[model samples]
Target: MYRIELDRDVCISSGKCVAESPETFRFDSDEIVELVPGAPRLPDEEIFDLARDCPSGAIRVFEGDEEIDVH
Candidate 1:
């Protein structure tokens, strides 16, 4: 399983991540990216792409016993 973490403070409210992975990310009423909880599983590449594409560098992707800093 992969874990995604978002730094709201650092997020610039950009939708780049959402564009990259709509299934895993969405914009709230305030247009801030929100990650759904307990959704279907995602491959590591999708998570990596979402994190890499985030303009605000607020996304962090992690795997079991491993961590990748997309920022």
Candidate 2:
């Protein structure tokens, strides 16, 4: 299982995360990024790609409490 965290302050609104995993992410009314509540689980590879594709490096992927793919 995995958990996703997004840093709205660091987000650039690039839409890369949403484009890669539409069911997992969406834009809020403020135009910032937010993880979809109760978003469907995604494969590990897809999780890595979501973080990798984030130009602002605002997306935080976690396995339990350990963050992944946030470089």
Candidate 3:
């Protein structure tokens, strides 16, 4: 399975990730982006898209330790 991570220190909270995939991403009380704990499994393409859409480059996807990217 894949893992999702959000670095709030770098996130700008543009809401693009939430708008693209609310099922797996959301905004915290502080307006920073966060992963939805226990979220349903998402396709690799969608996950990559979410990471690509994050303006601040805060979202990271991994299969173990290897980071994922759109290209």
Candidate 4:
């Protein structure tokens, strides 16, 4: 299983994440990325790809206690 997190302060508002995974992520009024409520879980590889694709490195993926290094 995997977990995901986003750092709003670190987001660049590039919209890459939202564009790639509209079902899982969206932009708020301020344009910062926010997770969609009750969104379906993505596959493990997709989760890692999404995190790695964040230009601002704002997306974080984890497996239990250890954070996956997507950089």
How big is the positional error of residue 53 in model 1, measured in Å on the Cα after superposition? Answer: 1.2
Q: Provide the lDDT at 1 for model 4.
A: 88
Q: Show model 4 residue runs off by greater than 4 Å.
A: none
lDDT of 2 by residue, 2-56 (tens): 7678889999998888887889889999888888888888887777778878899
Residue-level lDDT tens digits of model 1 in 1-71: 78888888888987787776677788888877888766666787777877888777888787776777665
The alpha-carbon lDDT assigned to residue 59 of candidate 2 equals 81
lDDT per model vs. reference: 0.78, 0.83, 0.84, 0.93
RMSD of 2: 1.5
Instruction: Report the C-alpha displacement of residue 59, candidate 1, in angstroms.
Output: 0.7
Q: Which numbered prediction scores highest in TM-score against the true structure?
A: 4
Give per-residue CA lDDT, model 3, range 1-71, as digits (tens).
77778888999989998988888788889988888888898888888887887788898888899887744
TM-score of each: 0.77, 0.85, 0.86, 0.95
Residue 40 lDDT in model 3?
Answer: 93
| lDDT for each residue of candidate 4 in 16-62, tens digit (9 for 90 to 100) | 99999999999999989999999999998889999999999999998
**Sort by TM-score, best first: what order?**
4, 3, 2, 1
Best lDDT among the predictions, by candidate number:
4
